[model samples]
Target chain A: MELADEAIRLADLPAADRRTIMILGHEASGIPSEALDLLDRAVEIPMVGTGHSLNVAVAGSLVLYKLAGLL
Target chain B: MELADEAIRLADLPAADRRTIMILGHEASGIPSEALDLLDRAVEIPMVGTGHSLNVAVAGSLVLYKLAGLL
Candidate 1:
C-alpha cells in the first residue's frame, strides 16, 4: 500500500500539520520506500490473535486520544 | 455519542449522498433517535474477545469493500 499516499489523500490537510500524523500498521517496516519520507512516525501494535491488525480509524483514534491525553 | 454528528462532520459530504452511508457499531440498536433519521443503515459485528468492536475505519473499509463487491 502507498501508505503515505493514503495518509495524504485521506487527511487532505497541510503538510506542516501532517508532521503530527502517525501511521500505525502491522507491517510498518515493510512500507514502501516512497512512504518513508512522508511519515512522521510509524507505529506497530502488538497483537496476539490470528488477526494481526487494528482498523485504521481505531488505531488513529487510539493515537489521537493518547495525544489528546484522553486514554 | 452523537453518531450522526460525528458521521456528518467526518464525511463532510451532502445529505443526499449520506443516504448511501451506513453506520456500524456494537451498539447499533442504542443509537439515538436523531441518528436513526440520519443513518442509511446500522450494522453490528459479533465479537469474540473482550474487545467488542472493530475500529471505525476497519469497519468502514469492510463495509465499503462489501458494498463495492470486493469482499
Candidate 2:
C-alpha cells in the first residue's frame, strides 16, 4: 500500500483497482490525512473550466472505465 | 452526419469530436428526435450499477479522453 498524490495534472499513473479517487466536497476543506495515508494510490480526473469537478456518479463511472480499460 | 443510438450495451462506437453525449436530466425527458438527428452519433459510458448515467461533466471528460486516446 503506497500513498500516492491524486492531483490530476501531477498524477501520471493510470487508474487500477488498488487506487482510490478522492473528490473534495464543497463544504469540506480537504481529505483527512489519515484517510489519504490509507489509500494505496490517489487518482484524479484531469479537468478544465470554471467547474471544480463533475457529479459523483459521473466521476465514478469514468473511474470504472479507467479500471476496466473501456476507454 | 449520421444519427446514432446511445444505449450503452448497444453502442459500439467510440467518442470523437464529431460525436455528442446526451445525459437525461433528472426531471427532463429523452433527447428530442430532431436534436438526435442533428448529432452525428450519440455515445454512452457503459455502467453496471443501478445508476443510469454519470454527471454531464464527468461524462464529457470521459468522452474527450476517449477522443484524445488518453485511456
On TM-score, the candidate that comes out on top is 2
Q: Runs in model 1 with CA error above 4 Å? A: A1-71, B1-19, B24-30, B38-40
User: Which pairs of residues have clashing backbones in candidate 2?
Assistant: none
Candidate 2 Cα errors over 4 Å, as ranges: A1-28, B1-29, B51-61, B64-71
Residue B36, model 2: Cα distance from true site in angstroms: 2.7
Measured on C-alpha atoms, candidate 2 has an lDDT of 0.51
RMSD (Å) per prediction? 14.6, 5.8
TM-score of each: 0.32, 0.52
Q: What is the TM-score of chain B alone in each candidate?
A: 0.49, 0.57
Poorest lDDT segment (10 consecutive residues) of candidate 2 chain A: A1-10
lDDT of each: 0.44, 0.51
Worst 10 residues of 2 chain B by lDDT: B1-10
Report how far off residue A70 is in candidate 1 (Å). Answer: 32
Q: Model 1: per-residue lDDT, tens digit, A26-60?
A: 44445666666676644433333496455556555
lDDT tens digits, residue span A1-71, model 2? 12235444312545465545544423234456777666555555555568765565665566566656455
